[model samples]
Target: MIVQQRAYQHPHQPSEVRLVVYETAAAARRVEGMPDDAGYLVTEEWRGAGKVIKTLGFFPDRTPALDVLSARAQELEGQLYRPVAPAA
Candidate 1:
């Protein structure tokens, strides 16, 4: 007789803010327009603690978007993942 083990698949976590790094705004614009939703993507250059510099892209709505960012920031703290980078 033989026993078999089952594999597990993790659920995809939905993010209101899309974290990405783009050299040009045009490329980022392309992704921003992909979603025909109401919210807009806020772009920024982030240069904080990390291996390499990264750009962030996120959506901020009148309610959920920014609210979630704030709460998550508080919860994650040093591990916070902003969609954009800070200005130089």
Candidate 2:
């Protein structure tokens, strides 16, 4: 399930990408350095019928995660990624 999510519009394209933090049954096996207690994940995804496009990395904490997203978000939006609710 999605624990956190944000969206960004492509400055030149007709699509948006989401920066998401989520949990899954096999979260531990997807990446190395993922602490057993983190229980959360971040990925680079393509929009679809709720499918992940790729695994970026794992984070034990969120601060650094935001930093990574922030940099990418700034390029398109000139600010941090805007928070958005996950689709149900």
Candidate 3:
């Protein structure tokens, strides 16, 4: 099973973070297969034990994915993150 949570912030909130969890590759794959608006997908594998288990998908970039999550965060009590353009 996968669970999503909002990242914590204090003092001055810089950006918002949303957690998308998955237990199996199939689940992660489903999320990956989701539309491009689901943010950039970064997979992190657990290798502490001899057997490899669990893969996590992190949508860190501010893309369509961020837009979708940002809305959800706002509704679910998540911090807001606005992406700024780099200075030339």
Per-residue accuracy of model 3 over 35-72 as CA lDDT, tens digit each: 43433543222222232323234454435444554455
TM match of model 3 to true structure: 0.25
Separately for all candidates shown, the number of backbone clashes (residues 3 or more apart, or on different chains) is 8, 0, 3
Scored by CA lDDT, what does every candidate get?
0.32, 0.59, 0.37
Best by lDDT: 2
Off by over 4 Å in 2: 23-39, 48-52, 78-88
lDDT tens digits, residues 3-76, model 2? 66677655455445777777645434644555556544677665655555565555666666656656655664
Worst 10 residues of 1 by lDDT: 1-10
What's model 2's lDDT at 74? 64
Candidate 1: residue 55 Cα off by (Å): 9.8
Q: What TM-score would each prediction reach against the true structure?
A: 0.32, 0.54, 0.25
- Cα lDDT tens digits, model 1, 1-34, are 1011111111332223322221223233444334
Candidate 3 segments whose C-alpha is farther than 4 A from its true place: 1-39, 42-62, 78-88
State in Å the error of residue 48, model 1.
4.8
